[model samples]
Target: MDFTPPQKRKAEESIVPMINVVFLLLIFFLMTSQITPPEPFEVTLPVSETLGDAESELTLHLSKDGDVQFEDFTGETAWMRLGGRIDPQTVVKLRVDAALPAPKLAQVMQRLSPTGAASVEIVAVQK
Candidate 1:
């Protein structure tokens, strides 16, 4: 009887195909994902049953306490600063907190009117 050592078996399956598939899935998700810019402040947007498309280069944020915040400015000063920089025909996107009262909303609109903006679009989440 011969006492021979068993030959080592080689791996029959290669993991290269599995790795390629995983990489392909990763690339697919990266391409399909939508990335939104982070807001300067937290805001609770109002919900709407109907959706509308409103796009603008300028955005104004309103807080629950009736305080308006803009790029590096807050309150009345923010509006003033925006008024000078924004064009008269530009559309302003107003992102106001849902908790804000109607009067406050009117006040903001009143203030915005002087800027000569063509229109103000209130941003809201569609339900």
Candidate 2:
């Protein structure tokens, strides 16, 4: 038997593989994720007693100041831009501020008519 005791082996565990796996998973999630578009602006919708399920491909937002916005455009120009994009057979969703006057809302509806939208749905929050 040897006089000296056997040397203890270093208990080293490699973590590089674990780190690589974590990074790969992070990249996978980032690549597969879908991001939703942000709202154009803040809006206070009117209250309604009856809620209906309505879906539309196009949306027009009306601010309390009587300004109409669609996508990145505003005012009359926005309406003109929207007219070009509207489909005759698709419904248009209108989100108007509750504080907006009725006449302003009517004006927006009138402008939409020339676009030949099949229908218009006014969006309102349930009471």
For each candidate in turn, the TM-score is 0.69, 0.77
Best model number under TM-score? 2
**Candidate 2 ranges with C-alpha deviation above 4 Å:** 1-25
CA lDDT, every prediction?
0.88, 0.88
lDDT of 2 at 11: 100
> 88-107, model 1: which lDDT tens digit per residue?
77999999999999999998
Report the backbone clash tally of model 2.
0
Expressed as tens digits, the lDDT of each residue in 25-118 for candidate 2 is 9999999998757777788999999999779868899889888888888887888888888887879999899999999888888878888999
lDDT for model 1? 0.88
Q: Ten residues in a row with the worst lDDT in model 1?
A: 34-43
